[model samples]
Target chain A: MNTTRRSFLKLMGVSAVGLSLGQLGFDLAEAQAYASKLKIEGAKEVGSVCPFCSVCCQIIAYVRNGKLVSTEGDPDFPVNEGALCAKGAALFSMYTNPHRLTKPLYRAPFSDKWVEKDWDWTLNQIARRVKDTRDKDMVLKNEKGQTVNRVDTLFMMGTSHASNEECAVIHQAIRSLGMVQMDHQARV
Target chain B: MPKAFLVDTTRCTACRGCQLACKEWHDLPANATKQRGSHQNPPDLNPNNLKIVRFNERMTKEGVVVWNFFPDQCRHCITPVCVDVADMAVPGAMIKDKKTGAVLATEKSAKLSPADAKAVAEACPYNIPRIDPKTKRITKCDMCFDRVSAGMQPICVKTCPTGTMVFGEREEVLAVAQKRLAFAKERFPKAHLVDMEDVSVIYLLAEEKEHYYEYAGFM
Candidate 1:
């Protein structure tokens, strides 16, 4: 039998306590209590909503020393009533994770590398691409001679992160450009 | 009065909100993991992860596959075996809080030798404790002692989208567990509460213990 030193130490540890339990007549209720320190005791709470889905569960982000300490569901919100899904519960990581992108990244048509681009440059690039695609693909009319304004080459994908007012504004802008291929990222 | 938890497995959708919430509360770092052909990640319990949702699939006699999810963590047993084991090697390494019945691994656990720490972890019947290779301190769920002591619910229970986890005074939680068990029995005749008398975390399993995890319960 390989008693090896590790298992032997473990065996002695277990049996030593087994004998001690009988000696002390240990009762859990009488065990020594400890006063624990709360992790968010002095942190500032900032209320926010989960951006993962339509539920939009409210959350309280605890920040201490200008850094996020903890995050949890907000009990006051009626939509989720303090309940959150996996993605919502993991909101803290999204905010603090090193891997998360803090700036816009752009890749050229055939480039094998991604380049960090400023917000102004990225927005201008998107606007320029949209204008070019719309001008090249906008259809004037259908085969039956009905006036139809549509851009087949351009597709617009929106996200649940947008508010109702923002969605309305975005939808109007996309429609005005005659982009027919549009979809919302959220189903529920 | 000591506090307790009532986990109704029938209500768990396996969304893993509680698992992630635990990590968020503890501020544990993320694990660099690859897909194991299942949604379960990080593979196994470690010093970094104090809680995890275990996924298992079993084939029923009806020829349909039944899935089971057990949100696994330390049970905080009424008489914790790990504490006893730790006390033998290093006196203050482990402690059981009288007010909340929360068995905790103290910072003094770093004093235990590698052999002694492994023994302390190995003594746990539920196999929960994880020893850090660097610090050699045994670690596991502390019942969110800091949160509960501050009059806030455990983050895991608070973030559960489904009413799968419940925490309250021990008696109140036990009553809730019994009521939930009765309700679940109608759908799953085998529904029962796991280790209610022995541990603070009372699990209302919807199926036999085998369906969940091999260590889901002890007689």
Candidate 2:
């Protein structure tokens, strides 16, 4: 009778695990495949690239209700396949950060604070400045009397945010203006 | 089957991708931070941040500088003592999900008195649970149950760049952890899995447990 009772207790212990059956010898709780609605479930998968470095790992931006909801490294991309560094992982917050500037801000030469400027005003001002600098610093003739048309004072610093095609256009436009000094700031 | 994590600390580069990924997945808000003279930011876990990578650097007995990175989170115990302690105060306040081996503190946790709430947090061996002063809700990692149940890996495991944080079925992950442990044993004679029998998440430490964190393993 004691043997029967002990055997029943053992059976009860075995039956105590959750509804699902699992492999023996591990603390695997019987988990059912519950389908929780994904946060980005219905969001459109828009492909893009990480704007932080030249590696430019592919990213899929999740857009829901016409707003960017999330971003993750694209699994399909061979480079950095579904893996991201701290900066790359923080792409979502970079877009949603309250400190992010949504408009152009202009500061006067001697001004202590920045004032908001319209895009038209900002672009026109930039064009005028670039033209003025190019005209003032244009060196047409070298020491050897060579026709080396280049700007000596204008330095064109490029952004990592520009795409490959955009970078090519930027290079063409700057070269046409006879600017020689150029640099990029992509790290890692 | 219950999911598990095999965290190999030796492989972790401490890029904090897991930390950021958790925040992104949960839609947790950012906390204000200052230069605390360490890479361990926000210092401790709060409602806003469920997971954090703890950085510790100190000299060993041999005068060797040892820098350790611990991606800290709640180790949902096999038989959770917190759930029992919480059940006495508010019945539905804290529950252990039988389906997923997930310990979750529900909205009813707000009903728990301040003393009871503090008691629950204090009961955790790993010192993981935190009671929000404003909400009175006992907050910690819920094993990322929502994502795991939906056939998706927890954000931390998915975003890890160095292949440090691995998540999968309990038996499979245990095998992985043991195999890695065998490899680690060659270099680190003292390397072992931390509280593997009692917790869902297992950390494979390269050296003594105290070197990583004082509460890294439960005796």
Give me the runs in candidate 1 sitting further than 4 Å from their true place: A1-36, A138-150
Best of the candidates, lDDT = 1
Report the number of the highest-TM-score candidate.
Answer: 2
DockQ of 2: 0.22
In CAPRI terms, model 2 is classed as incorrect
- Check candidate 2 and list the clashing pairs: none
lDDT of 1 by residue, B84-104 (tens): 998898886888877778888
Tell the DockQ for candidate 1.
0.26
Structural similarity to truth (TM-score) of each candidate:
0.85, 0.86
- lDDT (tens digit, per residue) of candidate 2 on A1-188: 55653245334434443223342221332122222345776578799888877777888898998999998877677887778888888899999999999999999999999999999999999999989988888999999999999998888888877878999999999999998889987632
The alpha-carbon lDDT assigned to residue B87 of candidate 1 equals: 88
Residue B180 of model 1 has an lDDT of 88
Could you tell me which 10 consecutive residues in candidate 1 chain B have the lowest summed lDDT? B144-153
Q: Quote model 2's iRMS.
A: 10.2
